[model samples]
Target chain A: MLKKGGFVLSAGLVVLLMVALIYQIKNKYYLDILFMTFFWASLAAAWNISGGYAGQFSLGHAAYVGIGAYSTALLYINFHVSPWIGMVVGGLFSALLALFIGVITVKVRGPFYTLITIAVAELLYISAIQLKELTHGSEGVSLPFKPGWVNMTFRERETYVVLALLFVALIYFITKTMERRRIGYYLIAIRENEDAARALGVPVKEMKLLATVLSAFLTAVGGAIYAMYIMFIEPDSVLSFAFSIQPALMSIIGGLGTSLGPLIGSFVLSPLDMFLRESFSHINGLNLLIYGFLLVLFVLFWPEGLWPNAVRVYRKWRSGGVETKS
Target chain B: MLLQLTVSGILLGGIYALIAVGLTLIFGVMRIVNFTHGDLVMLGMYLTYLLYKGFGLDPYISLFIVPLALFLIGVLIQKLVVQRVVGRPHEVQIFATVGLSMMLSNAVLAYFKGDYRSVQTTYSTDTIQIGPVFLGVPQIVAFGISAVITLVLFLFLKFTYTGKAIRATTQNRISATLMGIDVRRVYTMTFAIGSALAGIAAVLLMPLYPTYPSIGEAYLLIAFVVVVLGGLGSIPGALVGALIIGVVETVSAYYLGSGWKQAAYFVIFILVLIMRPQGLFGQRGAEQL
Candidate 1:
């Protein structure tokens, strides 16, 4: 599926679909869902950097997102800076924070490390709430929307979708590039067996830190974009546990470590999320209940996620093959 | 002033200890950190709350029924979901329980519509006379019940055959299986007992605190921290960790703001993770095991 020709073909198909979606979307509801799907796919692709490909699970991506959202919002609110620039500044800030945390926590692996990531993010969340002078406290910061390219805010909805699509495509391109290189091989080796990778003289800590920094930077960019689109940034909204989990969920669902796993995951889950919001608004938790059930079923039945399986089936049909097990 | 803080902290610690003991036990035996533990506590709250609301059963009287009901639910969850994920990778195990956490909490949200519900008894505001620190009757009762349950659990693990088998399994699953222990049965019982304790915590807390679908998160986070600080599988360690957290929370709330109390403990948690990931009493490689 990731062969150069195949990737090009698929990318063409997706671009065509995006083109159709932009003008054809009459329902604002479906447009919003599509926009979110692209946005979360981008965010999840960022998470896939450390989590999916590198096999370093961080439950603290929310920390970076929160930092990004808050940094851009605060800067724009106080200095009248354009968010187009604030996003870069926010990305840099997130990189520094990630470096400090990665330095301390890169050694720990597995669930213990997952716990540490959670703690760090929760600490950031609390700090955001308590440090009102800088963060504007729990009330958060709302951007005064002035629709223009300079502000990164747009008057048209489709423009935002186009921007989000570009972000996802950029992240996907980087992921594919990394996957075909020595760096990707090193990360895969480290994930498969850290001791073996170390014996082979891989700079395990450095690679892990690099992956974490890149992941945090991209996620922060996504955060900055989201804040501008919504014109509001709050700790609970951006720094939520659910925020951290969503990307991980999407990546895992579509197929962790695969180039297009997060995009597929987002495509599947985002519509459901939108449907539940629109139709089951009164049902409160039914959407999440189904989501949780699906997650359980996926982990149990197809831990490799739906992407690989879909590829295998498509290949089988294309080859006109007999019924045979992989 | 110090004495008052200490007394209150200890009382709060007792409540936290109840939540942590069950969590530690599950981790000890199954090697799976039950992320849905807080949800179980929340479910127990709704169960008792429903009884009080629908049937007019008093919160104090429904405690008995609530634990038993929760025990059955625990057994069902163990047999159905958790058993499948045992001996799996951390990713699978973590996500499974986290999935369960999302489901259970959201299920409650769907049913209850995210409203906070409280059950107040006839003596809801009644307080017992303590020399320096003012103690409410419900808190005193919760603390007393927690103490009793902890003692009983300690004795059970020490003297009972089933408990001994559980300890053996926790120490070494293969050896326990070799020694003719029904390791799976022991796992189910441990899960049930742990869940039942969460139910007790729910019932005990109902009189003092309001029940919301998300209320369990704060308690759950405290449980995770306490479990780690106390040593992953040590009951006595959980007790000690809870006391430390409780004191830290009360002290920080006094010095800092109440809003930052949980944050204060989270800092301590990170420090502990960096300085002593094995916790105060955990063995080396305990986390890996």
Candidate 2:
């Protein structure tokens, strides 16, 4: 009961922080950072469903992201459809693709699955680049700037922050709901040991497919928002391996398989990434070097991530009299 | 033209075989897929390039020095980094190697500035024509050297006492250890040998592909596809897989436009993966075993 209360309080505090952030939207840079951070957090959280919960290490998540971005952008550009409607269509399309990939590849466990995902992502990226007439190839596609509710555009940054926050909150609540359900338990069981889970009567393949489809859908939604926010979408920018790596990095660094991990990871890493972009533009690849080194260090030393440690601290404070050992 | 493409594909497959062998060697021995295997090859290429460009040594000659140096580095890395995380969870292994790959590639980028560099050898322009196809002398030389090295390595694994022990360890580490085969030593040696082969492949490929930090990613993806398509932990499988990939890629580039070549190969790669998850040469139940 106490743990549940603490969780609710912590979530409330996060909401309060988000509300405070909206008041600071006068600063466009700060608002942009918040939007990007939440965008990444949403994607990372979505990634954790399949990668962390289901334990399928997919390195090609950018495929779904690209699919969502391009699908919605194309609809908006060509058919004059509202982005709101396009987002749903794009998400479902990406989810279908994920389901297809999951059905074929999930039978193979471990590194083989990872290899297949990488291959699939690479193949998709190459196809997108080659199909220049449809995707605009390397040149990318641009959405016109129109101010309206249906278009999801605003002259001020506050609107974006509110929308992104809503997304983050929706995803967070969905994941929380999932964690309480039988599906989440099945995913965790499969993640721990597929054979054991199968023996326990869990439909491993179906559960994994569900996770992948849901993950793809959420990721696609995030991608759609991102395209709208940036007002431009390109194959290289959307489908690159670097973009695929981001969610993994964020999820792993923040805390895998936990509700708060993606949020924590985004808060910690996104700012550093922004800083690197700002400071090391001239250094070519030094920032990537630092990023890679940090990932290695985190893997070696703190695989449980920062949130677990923070949880311990919070628990200790709540105990009131004596600090408990983590 | 067809005959030429076939010959060139075969020669290119030789180099691919060499690179994939290193990756398979480590997998065969340790049952751990080294994600950084491609980066190690990239490092080998850079080391070979530096030796030639800075010290005025021929790339072929530097091959002897580079592999030995890389072997030592590999041994050290295995002992210090890889060994520490050997028995941990799967995520740890993936993250460690993935992290290592990222670090190595980015470090190279920081140092080399992403320039495409190739060893300017005298034989670079020299080509020999046979029938309809003209083949570069350097590529032919690389093919021959790679074949010779692969043959020698095969002989060593088949004949040498230590080589037999490595193979035994690869098949069953616990049984090998129970039989007093010193599995630790086998792992170290396997890592060194695998890295050494990567080093050799780098030198052989440097004359053709040019050296760049991100070049590893391009080859890494291909090597990974070859490794998977061939079956993990199978050397001969790597060779066959490489040949198939090389032929497919070359043919696609010839028939389809160059732009569609990658797409065509990737389609084939995904189709094969979906159809035959265990690969053509991979032993059934070997993954679980």
Q: State every prediction's TM-score relative to the real structure.
A: 0.96, 0.95
Docking class of 1: medium
Q: What is the fraction of true interface contacts found in candidate 2?
A: 0.67
Candidate 1 lDDT (Cα, 0 to 1)? 0.87
lDDT of each: 0.87, 0.84
Instruction: Please report the TM-score between candidate 1 and the true structure.
Output: 0.96
User: A1-326 in candidate 1: lDDT tens per residue?
Assistant: 37888886788688878777687777777678878988899999999999987788888899999888988998898998988889989999999988988877754667777877888898899999889899988897888978888888888888888888888988998898899899999998888888899999998998998998999999999999889878888889999987788898898899988888999999999888988888888898787888888888888778889898888887788779754465
In candidate 2, stretches whose alpha carbon ends up further than 4 angstroms from where it belongs are: A2-17, A316-326
Cα displacement (Å) at residue B166, model 1: 0.3
Kindly report the docking quality category of candidate 2.
Answer: medium
Candidate 2, residue B78: the lDDT equals 92
- Give the Å shift of residue A275 in candidate 1: 1.1
Report the first chain's TM-score for all candidates. Answer: 0.93, 0.93
For residue B28, what is the lDDT in candidate 1?
Answer: 92
